[model samples]
Target: MKKQMLLAAMSLAILSAYAGAAPTDKAADVPLKPAAQQTQAAVWASRVLSRYHYKATPLDDAMSEKIFDRYFKSLDAEKLFFVQADLDKYADAKQKLDDAIVGENLQLPFNIYNLYQQRFAERIAYARELLKSKPDFTLDESYQYDREKAEWPKDETEVKDLWRKRVKNDWLRLKLAGKDDKAIRDMLDKRYANYMSRSRKLNNEDVFQIFMNAYAMSIEPHTNYLGPRASEQFDIQMRLSLEGIGAVLQTREDYTVIREVVAGSPAGMSGKIKVGDRIMGVGQGSTGPFTDVLGWRIDDVVALIRGPKDSTVRLQMLPADAGPDGKPVTIALVRKKISMEEQSAKKTIMEVRDGTVKRRVGVISLPTFYMDFEARRKGEKDFKSATRDVARLLAELKKEKVDNVLIDLRNNGGGSLTEAVELTGLFIDRGPVVQQRSAEGKVEVENDTVPGLAWDGPVGVLINRGSASASEIFAAAMQDYGRGIIIGEPSFGKGTVQTLINLDRFGQGDKARLGELKMTIAQFFRINGGTTQLRGVTPDIKLPTIADAENFGESSYDNALPYTVIKPAVYIPAGEVKDIVPLLEKKHQARVAKDKDFQYLVDDINYVKKQRKENMISLNETARRKERDQQEARAKLREARLAAAPSPDDPILVPDPKEGLKQAVSPKPASAKAARQAAAVKGASRTDDGLQGDERSLAAELEAEKAAKNAKDVLLNEAVHILADEVGLLKTDTRLASRVLPYTSDR
Candidate 1:
């Protein structure tokens, strides 16, 4: 099954910045050890997690105290550099890290990563000696920048007053983003000397990829280990080619964030780089100099934002809805490549009126369940497949008669489980579409011997929290065969199933490289037998998103993998969307309570869940400039009530039923008085590092036209008005349209 349909396409796109040759600041001052093939790759990754881990867990002593508190929170995850007496001097090596990963003993995780590189070079030499001076912005202190779950400092004078309120919250976030005080002390002394030259370039394969991914995520969270330079960036993201600026990066502490932009690459068509932004300076072409990358190393800021495919790089960023007193911006882009036709599956359509009846709906989107499996193993009769381009966009939306389709799969994050069981046999006309099991128990299923129905009308899927794992196996087999209407926000539960392995083919002849593991040998279920693992696909219409499910997906992985059950397989019900979901949730909650853009997206998902539950901030500069001027006066009154409302319709494109109707136009609307006259001509061209050159290209063209009018897909325009109110209640309910239509006697 192509190794059980290889699916971990989680795409953390660093594309090519991890396979060795980077240690030269005088070989980053030596010290880091254990690389003679990482003690037999940590005893062959602790006997492949005690023999093939589909959560057979057990590396005892409570998984070595959860791999010694996930290797000191993967080396200080903001509990800021070691203190509870440096974790009570290895608190007796927390039950001996599972007998030092089954006796290969990498000297207590390289002496707790050499005392977290000596308390991260003594907190970057006390934050470059508190950037020498200025920091009394009218007292009234507050910092606690969400120390993950706080607690550590009970010594070194409470860890130098938590690095003096983290260098006064990094000089009150560059003095509320306008800098000056000698440009925030020359950018906090080159961002604490690029955090002591990236914590003196942490080597020994970066402390054996942070103690074998803190003992492979303490036995679960998708068992990893990758190291031989992240197994060559996981085989260059499984051959979905690459080059650069297609973003997807992580290392959060000293920020290099921006996780996932990629879609049509050049950082997703430069909608000015988003996904929790951050980057903080890279710069190369058209005036190079920038560099600062806060504290580098997300593989050296992805090898300084990888280059050469049509050059230029730039970046700077910060945005993710501003907050650390915001204003960073910059951008630029250019680099290219990223295409599997920019992660394939396309289509569009939308329409949805209903009063005088406009309906249409189509959509498709997909974004990853790709195939090209080496051009279908070289027999290439037109290969690149997401089920042969969504079965040719469901036969060109059934020759443009498009009544209702949808799909989308929100931020997809999944790929080829045989193209999610051949794209769930294009709207099910067959059986068993997903069940797996493995780690020896054995189950299997995966059917759909492709027969008919590639667009069994009135469908809807969508999904959010970044969909996931074969997009939770095609939205849990279209919510267990009542084929479609699983709207939004729930899916990323990643029901197990990883595979990789390779450790240089168990290196017996000692070629030394030994890397890849990925592991989690199979789990997914749902052919009615439950288990989208830690509870994913729950959407018969649960919209208003901004991600929370206990803080973003797979139940925010504190060692994920739980919700079980299995044994239903023999399938059949391809119809009945739960008797029209309470009349499509009473006409989708009376049109989202008179939708002012879905109440400005439920007031921006309740102000991002009240700023993710307020983890303290106010380092006072007049209460942080009156909370950044009341968040830019509630974002200029939600962009002047979305520029006095009434916009939403424009989706059209879907027409290639042999090129019949093509003119769809749209883009040209940024109003709120041209974003308050591009914020008063970029506030008279701000300087201390805010806006520059052609006023930062007219503030990145009014922030890519207010991020294309806040990327209006308002939950796929309420899943196209709930699939056009289920195609206007199945055109006067023919027994709920003969149990959910689809047998159009060969159209």
Candidate 2:
């Protein structure tokens, strides 16, 4: 489901301006249908939204105006492309957009898009012309990179000046990085060309998706229109089973970047690919010639890499920080199905000693609430699931006789709502887990009927802003029941539900394939009556975190559902820890007040905030170089101080000894045959390509060893201390223990 969700939003990448050598008069006749002629799919999409959207916004003049404004903003958020005149010229279409959508007329949007393309082309030509001459870097000026709130350029001349400064800054940055003039120009030329060529390839479907999405998103931020390709990709991702290299790919500049490698998958286990590595080329099998993928469409690259099970895909990649002169490295991986093991619940036991007494706290880190729905439907006895895995892990922890359990849900973005409810059942007896309110104001209570409790011991659930939807449901449920103490940062507030509606399903036989609509149809609320919409579940024990609510939470989204409360559900409260919270908080405050790592984190966050406030960097070459040098010197000083200081005793403050080793070494395989096959592929590829595999392996291992020494986690260590404190208090304080355990009457 995570993968499907990724693909659904893949096509939403901003189409950045791509400058190239001046073209012959703005390619005026680039083919496109007039905007007034709406496709059957467009009409079907509009109808679907009106009937099924959670926020039933009317497709009227007011909505049309909003969509018009949003669509243009989406095209040029930075205000670099279109001028005020362009918007003014298209002003009449603002009110007519509502009529066009209802009347199944798309001519207005298409016309707007056509005008945008023309201006985009002209700007690219102008930018390319400016790049022909060297830029003046001696001027003491600042370039405002963020322009979301800035007004549009007043005229073509103003936009040209902005581009000139932008190009100059780009050139200066490369020059400061020690690149030769020729190298800088070559790289810039290629990047610009790639941008232009890619933009030129945008067909009607791309325009339609962009426009329709603006409309749907005006209704609610999560609601979107995915084109045919994006829809298919989303479906494949939802299966959570794919025969591919298991790397998330995105296009940045001219290179196809590896955004992430799924843990326990072929790419991840290979230890050859890294996040941000640029794939220069791809090959199939042993003998296939590597095809240069520069300027290629992202989907094209994705299709080339994704193949049948047991097949081989070889990636020629440049390291993330590589310069223009950097050489590409070859990595061969045997493509296989990325299984649930990568994202399943993982358990670790941490020992915290209070003076003479020692306690073992079990930590279960669940990345996402997931279940193989198709596999379960097929009657597979051991279909991998979050609830099932957590249940097994809980039993294991109990067997180990741990005093308390901490469920680390940090960075969990959520999946499968049903699994969230079932997983919540593991900690407590069945009851209403969450409430759902549909578009028609119909409320439904989702209950967990399972009677058995997995771990009724003292529990702590850790969360952060990355935790959303299903994560919030479980956290809020536990907090309400007094089943556990909530810790860490407040969660991501995403309370609404999205249902994927396949437009193809609505069409008759032989209809042109319309994409899918991820329409928001309902909002979820906690059993305690509050919705984790704009305001998510607040932790009882707050930790130092970099997540700012205004910038990072659901409130960041323009159309997110507001925080609201509903009638509380009838349920029994297990107990409350209002009395114990202050003590825990005091201990946390005292520990972090002087702790070196915590203080350092606080300083770093403040520095980042300061940098954000002072957003503009000096465009002058001398000033920029001096600033860079100062930063480097400070970084070196900090590094030396850390090296001279004694290592912290807590694992959270101290680096993980095996952390770097995990990344360097191949992940432990699920099957011996799979491991052997991977080994065989690596050996065969090395021999076929005449590569020095041993030398590379040794270098990677040595680097990993060095990095592993520096990987620290103060957050986890602090969480352990908090839990240990809870255990100690529960044992010594009768009142605290009484609130946590079953009441005397129930017993």
Which lDDT value does model 2 have at 510? 68
RMSD of 1: 23.1
Give candidate 1's TM-score. Answer: 0.34
- For residues 134-170, write the lDDT of model 1, one tens digit per residue: 8787888787766867888888888888788878877
Candidate 2 lDDT over 1-747, as tens digits, reads 322121111112111111111112124467555332236667788888887688887788888888998999988888999999999998888899877766776777888888888887887777777767888788889888667778999998899888887777777777887777887777666556655766776767677888888998898877888777776554443334557877767666667777667777888898888877888998999779998887666776777787888999888999987886799999998988765354467777777777688888888888666667667778899876778889998998888788888898876766678788888898878789999898788899989898968887888998877777788899999999988889988877888877778788767676557777987778899998999888888999998655555556688777677888999898888767666788889888998887776666566556555554676878898998886676566566556656775444453221224442221111221122223322332222111111222213334544744563334556767888888888888889776688776532233
Candidate 1, number of clashes: 0
lDDT of residue 636 for candidate 1: 73
137 in model 2: Cα distance from truth in Å? Answer: 3.6
C-alpha TM-score for every candidate: 0.34, 0.80
Please list the C-alpha lDDT of all candidates, in the order they appear: 0.71, 0.72
